[model samples]
Target: MEHSKIISAAMKINQLTDLNTYVIDNSGEFVFYHEDISIPAFMPGSGQEDVLNLYNQMMIQQMNQLYSYTNEWGLHYLGYSFSTNDSFAVIIGPFMYLTPDMYGLSREYNLRNNESEDLRSMCNQIQVLKTDKANSFASILQQFELLINKEAVPIRIVANKDNEKYRKRENNSIMNDDADIVTMRYKLEGNIMHAVEQGDKTTAIKLLNSNDMLFSFSERFPNQPLRRVKNLAIVLSTLLRNAVIRSDVPAIFVHRVSEKYAYEIEYSNQLSKLQQLYEGMVEEYTDLVIANTLTHYSKVTQKVIEYLISFYDKQIDKNELAELCFTHPSHLSRKFKQETNMTITGYQQMIRMNQAKHLLKNENISIEEIAWLVGYEDASYFTRVFKKETGYTPSQYRENN
Candidate 1:
């Protein structure tokens, strides 16, 4: 195969997967590099020198095979060695098999005061993949090797021996048996909450599903399976609620969701329903964080936004909102516009339209009822507003959607 063809294939793979790809000569120099996402410079042993050294190590092994490397920081990579007139290898990654442990990295790397923040920011930039997804990534590298080298090679995961040792060391560091379980459980819960707060529903749900044993209440309840499952569901609901609250989602929204789940958790008779509810809770709370979190808004603006969301079906008076936010009406309007890029009435209208659409989906509610329900007294006026906002009349939206 021509070297240019190999480079072109690697570039195509990089573009397709958004993973960094490199073609390095046998001399351990990069002949071509395609970086879609920037890898963090501060990550230990993730630099050019480290990459070249790892390639040399693979060369010394003298095997034209695909290899995986996971450094101490939990960053993963794939390498495939091949020859096209000259010896060369294609490298991909700096992806992750697990979320990076910021505290562990800070302790192990002896990061200076300012470097800890840099490490955290960098850790956020890396793609975290589950085991199956990581395996799929390995298969991508295999396909890339077949494209360039014209032969198939088995994926041999190397560089994870140290990872095993690190895990053993961590496991051995735990002092007491009961405390160890408690600590491990808290760590997993913390990870779930952090993922939820970031609106990472995939990571949060993945962590939750993968760590079911830690969350099992069966052992404690013995024969009472339904009671155990319901208790577990309630605990998970509380955790998700707190996570979204920490993300600065309005208390009203969080409370409504929490209450809805609370009712379902208690009323659910089957364990399967409870199991499904756990994922639902994570998904809804994460979506709340994504859609309703007001962390970036000023306090007054946050209050106004919350008010709009909670009372979109009722008539809104700017003076009342101004008084509620402890500011004059004009200042509140300006601040709200500056922060949200929408006037108070405009924001309220958006909320009304969203609610109107949701109600329209039910098909049981008439347009006039929905109009009254969403704060418009005149049904025709509500139809005009709904049509203007959605490019469909309420009845048309119900029929189409």
Candidate 2:
């Protein structure tokens, strides 16, 4: 039930945004998007650095590593980001066990047949009656709605009419008119189809991986398993073949190859059952990879985090952590940033502030003691940092609460 809750919650929260979100800090956690509500002309804060941090957090929390397993199947993590230039890159990790491979495409089947016939007939009529961009948008929306209602896959749709910035991002240049956006998608799709025809697997794969691919294909075919199956199966197959040929592919990828290919190549129930077994292996060990990352370093940063959490509000010296984690001043700073996305001092300060919020709400601890506990020997300095974090002083917070 706990596992189910986490999965459902993760899927539920994914509907809000297109930004790559993450569930950080611990295992099997929920990924969330804190919407960046700002004017179009304004630049996002801190550029791509925060984006990378968020991605890392999501990867770590979802156990979206190569060695993690689902309950019954093994899986691999393919992380990619599509760009304005219509190019992207992926980070393929080692494979891990996940869930058993079920024979039927349950989600796809539901998506295909779940729409009311009346509404379905209406969609068909709309697709035929209107030759303009609006009808095209409506058709895409209906298909997207069906996919969302049935399969629970999170997708974002921004009409070219309302989203000029997104259009610029997709096309890599400013657009003069809405028709241009439609033309751009058409052109991109043509490029994708051309690549597919020319046996350019790399370009074809890139197009198929885009948000637009999912949109266009889902609308065009409406839940046909063959349309969906070829992409996933082919990618897994390619990864497997590559691993075998290269000899450097991880054990998990080899296992997936053996399992998926057995089903594709042999087509026996026994092989299918074996595929399930392999999938489970992928999910489980992928989680193990993420778990190992937390304790992966036998070094000081982990010690610093653990010690600070244990101490709660207690003040400990930076020098004390150096001895405890066996890290020198500069190296410790570097290590914390490398692993945790924040400087050691910054993390400690965040910890102190979070702990202070909890303590002030529950306990009768004074601001001064809370300061001392969080390693700030001076009450004034503690107050300053606290205000910086929460926008309220200790007394102010306590009084307001």
Candidate 3:
């Protein structure tokens, strides 16, 4: 977390010439760096003086000189440089303290920002230095920054023996191209869906909040272009198709925000009508895909449904009813003609309107409460919508019948 530690690590790394180095600590913790890369550890467990004496003897035997040390916060950090910018460092703390988690983190700089490439190199250097303990490897990098460079890059040094998920994320995020952004979008979207399906709402929420999808979305669609309902619907449609074919859920949710927001703010009858436009595209296209009735309708229909359902409750969306009916949008459109039956938007409006009517008729709550309860942002709008749907304003209906 500290910036100084990373800078020190970078400075120390630039000072080291040979991959062969030794860390003999009396600090009561095992030292590890990269195995099969650097010299074996020669730990001389004794008092600091005795260890320093032995270090001196070993250095004299090798004809080396001039190590750097800093005393601050009641602890000491030392830097041993082989050249101007290629060396390593160490931080020593109190006699009784647990070492920090240092595995896979860049000690020479903070690994948080635009310096990922440099931090990655430092990680590689840690391996070359043969430091094995996650904490010790990280300690050297942290101390290296403070001792030599005077700053640290934001980096984490957690040890992952076999997992390469981060590696995939980083690799997939290369370049700010549409393909790259879409890849990240689909990957994260799929991840969130899987989490949700597994009844891991916590994990799903965490994945959503992790900024990975946010970054991808922002990068791909600047000025919040996806904020528009129509644009978002199209993206969702595209992504849903991709998800169903590729079985990617992250992509589905990533593009469903438009539909989500529409559903969220559908209380105004006028807006509810507008929502039909968005819902129409999603349902029609998805049904085509699910039914496989058309050449264009691939497996993408399920993904679109998944995307919409993720943001809207299943009860309100009538997912079970939609699935059981096997009703294609076109078939219903032809049959209902003027009735507006089976269109995606029509179904959505029907559900919203039904809920509104129930709240108005069954409860003594104010129209404003009903507006919000049914997802409208404006009470007056809900009034107009109620009038259009039922031939009377909410108050007028209550007054007459």
Candidate 4:
């Protein structure tokens, strides 16, 4: 099989599914890749990628050989045999984690790194999760990869040209003026963000609809006009997520909606579907700003809400939240209840239970595991809370849905 066919198929499937897709050559080069910036960036602050790259090179060095591998960091790889006599393999994914088996990831590891600015930069890009929760989501990602590999389709890969042709094209591409394209991309991003910040839905929608220049896609497959639109949708969704955050929408609300639209954009294989989501996402954030009267609530209450949504998985203290919000615990508590018509603990429980519903629907973990994932230490207590909210135990919800 031509390697480009596999890469294009992986990219299409990635757009349809909520997973990052990558194809590594036998020499461990990232020849093709698609990763959403919406997914939190994470990497060990050392030579982790270099070490893993060496392992991949070693595994696929021999022709007709294959390997299924995982490491201390959250990478699950399946090396597929691609050549009969030549040593070529297609390695897919740097998945989250699988089976919650961290292999002592939390413990100190062996990789060495100089404490330099590069190391600090790597650490800043990293985001860590609890052992149990990371494992759950990682397993889900593994399953997605399995389905993609099984049903991987053929895509019309644009063929690379000979050296003479390639050099001529490269020279022409360099000479071509692309300043306009860059300006258009950035202008749309900035203009949409401004509308969202100002809560001006009219301006945002007008900008989205009027911009044939910004939203136009190139022809890929003859019948697939939306082919180029697919890639643009990823960038558009990312910009819209930032707009929603700047609009002062609750972080929890932003997280859920951003995730929803990301998947929606992925599976939108039709031009109309892509256009609908494109226009809707821009307007949606602007509408949130219009509706969210955050001034009605104190900044302390708003900060507390943001903090809880961000660190919902970890055990949190009331006093600590109050201190961070710069208010007396008692006064903040009263203000939170009066403004939101819900207590602080009550709101936190609501969000946790909502997330549990998501995990129950999407993951293959046990009820006990799900409880722990949503921050309930005692399974029995979690069941009680779940039953009270949804009239179904976690198992029943999983089974019924």
> Candidates ranked by TM-score, best first?
1, 4, 2, 3
lDDT of each: 0.75, 0.41, 0.40, 0.58
Among these predicted structures, which one has the highest lDDT?
1
Candidate 3 error regions (>4 Å): 1-181, 197-199, 210-215, 221-260, 263-401
For model 2, the local distance difference test gives: 0.41
Model 1 Cα lDDT, one tens digit per residue, 175-219: 554675676688788778876875667768878876677788456
lDDT of 4 by residue, 37-140 (tens): 22222334123352345345545354333344444344444344334223344434434322122212222332222222233333223332334644444333
Best by TM-score: 1
lDDT of 3 by residue, 1-401 (tens): 23344443443443442222234333423132212232112211223433243344333332122232211111122323222232322322211111111222222223332244333322233321112342453445444434533544444332212225333433443454456446556566655434333223443545544433333334444664434433444454454345344432344443454355445434333534444444343343344333432233223343333333332222333344344446655543344334332454544444456556655655566887677555566889878877888898888777775
On TM-score, the stronger of 1 and 4 is: 1
Candidate 2's C-alpha runs over 4 A off are 1-299, 312-320
Error of 2 at 243 (Å): 42
Of the two candidates 2 and 3, the one with more favorable lDDT, higher being better, is 2
Alpha-carbon RMSD to native, per candidate = 18.8, 25.1, 23.6, 17.9
- The order by descending lDDT is 1, 4, 2, 3
Per-residue error (Å), model 2, residue 6: 67
